[model samples]
Target: YEPSEDALQVEVDTKTIPHTEFLTYVFTDLSSTGATVALDWAKKQIPFKIEFDVSAIVLADIRQKLQGEAGFQRQNWEQAATFAMNNGGDLQEALGWINNAIEGQFFSSKTFNNMAVKAQILQKLGQKDKVLAMVPEMAGMANTNEMNNLGYMLVNMGENDLALKYFKINAKNNPANANVFDSLGEAYKIMGDRKNAIKNLKKSLSLNPPAGVKANSERLLAELGVVI
Candidate 1:
């Protein structure tokens, strides 16, 4: 297989070890216990200045295997996160590791997709506050249904602080979307923020909402004792 140009660079043995012996060392150390052994081997193999493409191939394979392992030990959380983000490995364990990655810069240069993966894991863990905290300022994450679902879930969980923040962000990001406005109105109503609730509900009605949205908004406006 071709060595990818995107190769990992680390430290290697100044004393030349034979390739067969290195492979033997790896399998003997890591195969059944999880991949940190190969990862350790690969880290030790990364020379300050790489001189051979053949070595890059082995290093890439070692990192790939390490990145794909599902080990859940707190010490292994970083690797678990890489596997979870890239390979759908373990949502629960990924949360712990991603938080660690964010804190420790383990992800090289974390992408918006990596942050989105964190949000996804938090949502799966039913952590409304954390997911809501993660959504704003997360670039390219504008799935309307996902926002509504998260907002409603927060509301159901009585996390009004997070729900209001989430729906307000959804409304701001999706100004003309009546469903977003309706969700915002419900959050405000739940907060006893009657004035904003009635205003958003009216805006939702005027935006030519989907079939059921108009009725829901009007009912909420009435419940807020506002004439709409």
Candidate 2:
């Protein structure tokens, strides 16, 4: 047997068997008379293998973009909660989403992140004891980002000293990140340490935030009566 660009050729010993019967079988199985036609055209002696070619078969591809769209529609509260928690680390927005999720019964029975989100919502809602209860569950799962988020929640709840500990951990892990400096500055400001606030805020600005963040940081510094 030999393979061509589009087909396979088979050689059979004509002395052993007649070509006509073999051609009929090949044509019947292939569902094409082209193989039989090619066999007749070949000048080689009988009992030779004939060449048959079939076009390549391809299956259609499926795209999964709709699955993502559906997931977003079905989990908007969770998505918004995650976004607000990560971006500004805003407690109110996180709490709003958590409350929405709870009232809507969106994802109340899930694992760690879900529990953490709910605990954070409680912290923002002034349920400090409840938030503290969830801390043990969150401790082993905590990362720099999680610590930063907890720090932000603590800051909003006027627990500046505790907030500083988490923010310091986050800053230590991510020294070059401007948001860490910004968060540390916010913590210092809450603690009534204007000098450290000014210093860290300046460090945040020095890292060269994007245009929007730079403008907002500048406005915040000005509000704090810092000459930035």
Candidate 3:
């Protein structure tokens, strides 16, 4: 079966499957790729062939199954958390599994997704305070673009104050990066703080941001009626 749109394909020998076993093995193996992908494939392609319950394949259980897998444990945990969050599974359980993933030795590679998923879970669980408390940790784990995107997400969620907190942490952690300040300036703009907005926009421009950031900063300044 070819999962993706590309030409790569996977051949499975169905002869080994007993009638009762059916597609359970295939479902479980596909889950190793991700529960969401497995569920999507099952729902769309093989509706009745798979008989497993979604809730039974818990994030906690998947976390346990992924233990001591050599180098891929962190990635597996991250995928588990993502699946739980996306598939209407338990949010609190997903939070724990994702925290485990983040604390794993190979976390840096999965940092962005881990933090993003955790923040989303926290928000969904009405633990917005925890999201704020995660600013420092997020700054450490997530890259500049990831943090910036999270901050903008908060802004879109109308949590301008929380967005400010995230942007501030990003700016502190990435002092030389222009996008951080640009995002900070944008957050301030959304919060109706013209002084700080203009301040950070100027800072972003002074640091020689990329063309997109430069144009955005210039446009914001112009809208604020400030001559650059």
Candidate 4:
């Protein structure tokens, strides 16, 4: 029979069959239809196993390890933790599993989704305060651009003090980034702090920021009545 589109190789070896078993094995390049034909003719499935070298017990052990829930837990720690948290299971155990997976040789479970799983577990355990305490970790995990743009957003919303709060935090966290100083300068300029604005703007310019940032800071400084 013609092989299906998904077939890599299809062959029927008659020499492999037992002569005394009164069985004529017809291996077809069939998928579901082949199974149906085999069931109708042979009353049992002739499994498609390529390994003639390995013992059946070895194959069985490998199959069990692969298809078992232990295999799922080993590979899918994130998914398993998420499921445990969602189902209101033993959250501490789930948290342990997640943390171990993160710290272990598997993958990066310190990310947002895995952290969200920890939050969900904390919420489930009635430690709402601890869940709120994840805010610091979340803030620490915030990227530089995230902090800068958030401060700019607050400034646009007419919350200059709040913008300064985030900008100062950004500056403290990333003192070396020229764009952070530039953003802080803009926020200070919006708040009418011409002195500090010029200070940070000059700092940004001195640090050699992006192409337009120096010119933007210089223009803002000029608009703030700074001579140069």
- Output the lDDT of residue 200, model 1: 87
Give model 4's TM-score versus the native structure: 0.41
Task: At residue 186, give the lDDT of candidate 4.
Answer: 87
Candidate 3 local lDDT, 24-89, one digit each (tens): 323443442343212223223332232356655665477577665622667777777788888778
lDDT score, candidate 4, position 197: 93
Measured by TM-score, how close is model 1 to the native structure? 0.42
Best by lDDT: 3
Root-mean-square deviation per candidate: 18.0, 19.9, 12.1, 15.3
Off by over 4 Å in 2: 1-112, 120-127, 136-145
Model 1 off-target regions past 4 Å?
1-140
Q: How would you encode candidate 2's per-residue C-alpha lDDT over 1-228 as one tens digit per residue? A: 335564645656543333343343223233432333234323333433344332211000001321344323425556556555554555675676556554555444344566677776665567889887776556556776676777776677776787888777777778887877887887887788888878887888998777765776677688799775
* Candidate 1 lDDT by residue in tens digits, 72-144: 2333444446555455445665676667555554443344545655776777677767776665645335477
Give the range where candidate 2 is weakest over 10 consecutive residues by summed lDDT.
54-63
The CA lDDT at 67 in model 3 is 68
lDDT of every model, 2 decimals:
0.64, 0.62, 0.74, 0.66
Indicate the TM-score of model 3.
0.53
lDDT of 4: 0.66
Q: RMSD in Å for candidate 2, one decimal? A: 19.9
